[model samples]
Target: MADITGIPPQSIDPDQALWPNAGTIRSSNQTNAAGQAGNAEKPTANNKDGIYVKDRLEDKDVKPEKIIFSNKLEASTYLKLQQLATYGGENIQEILEAALTAYFVGKEEASRPLPPKVLAVLRKKYPFL
Candidate 1:
């Protein structure tokens, strides 16, 4: 499988136009009247000269949480649920609950802890003692 970078290029017909206007194609190096490229990169919220929040690190609203997965199957299922949530206009929590319900309905063993090595590492890093 190809490395995860961005969207992979799909095979399309060369004769058919990709966009709405077939003839007119916008160039990235398009210049204005002053002979300078009008396509200037705007600073994002994370950038130094950004117009948005000056210090995102100091922001109280950015409450980041970590979600630990047991296996690749669970991780893949969670990713699918996330996509489903986005497409179906449902919240992630709702999607996750629905997925978990479906998953547990047929399964006998519901609760399973992380592997010994993983648990040990996690315990060492984030000790309860």
Candidate 2:
């Protein structure tokens, strides 16, 4: 194949390979003037996994960690959610959180203090309470 192409496949010396991050994905957040990421060669605790982006907290801009949650909803329900978001000029997350908060608050209003006897039994069963 090399002879047909008139080019030879030269072996690469690992130590002298330029652009160390040539094949790895890199974000715009971290890159040197040479377009190579700075810490690709070393595997630190943060870079141990495949994720190689800089820690946002290190930049003094902390954001709440978000966990992905998803469930199948009816097509109508999904469409309504999108329409509500657009109408309110808010994302579905904000709308859903607000709705859940209101629901919890409404449910909490129905709560009544435990009876003395029940409280006594609970206290006896669980001293911490």
lDDT of candidates 1 onward, in order: 0.49, 0.56
The regions of model 2 sitting more than 4 angstroms off are 1-62, 108-129
**Cα deviation in Å at residue 81, candidate 2?**
1.1
| Candidate of highest lDDT | 2
Q: After superposition, how far is residue 46 of candidate 2 from its true place, in Å?
A: 19
C-alpha positional error of residue 100 in candidate 2 after TM-score superposition, expressed in Å = 0.4
Q: Residue 52 of candidate 1: its Cα lDDT? A: 47
**Top candidate by TM-score:** 2
Per-candidate TM equals: 0.28, 0.32
Model 2 compared with the native: what TM-score? 0.32
Query: Alpha-carbon error at 110 in model 2, in Å?
Result: 12
lDDT of 1 by residue, 6-40 (tens): 66767677644443222221232334312422333
RMSD of each predicted structure: 16.2, 13.4
- Scored by Cα lDDT, where does model 1 land? 0.49
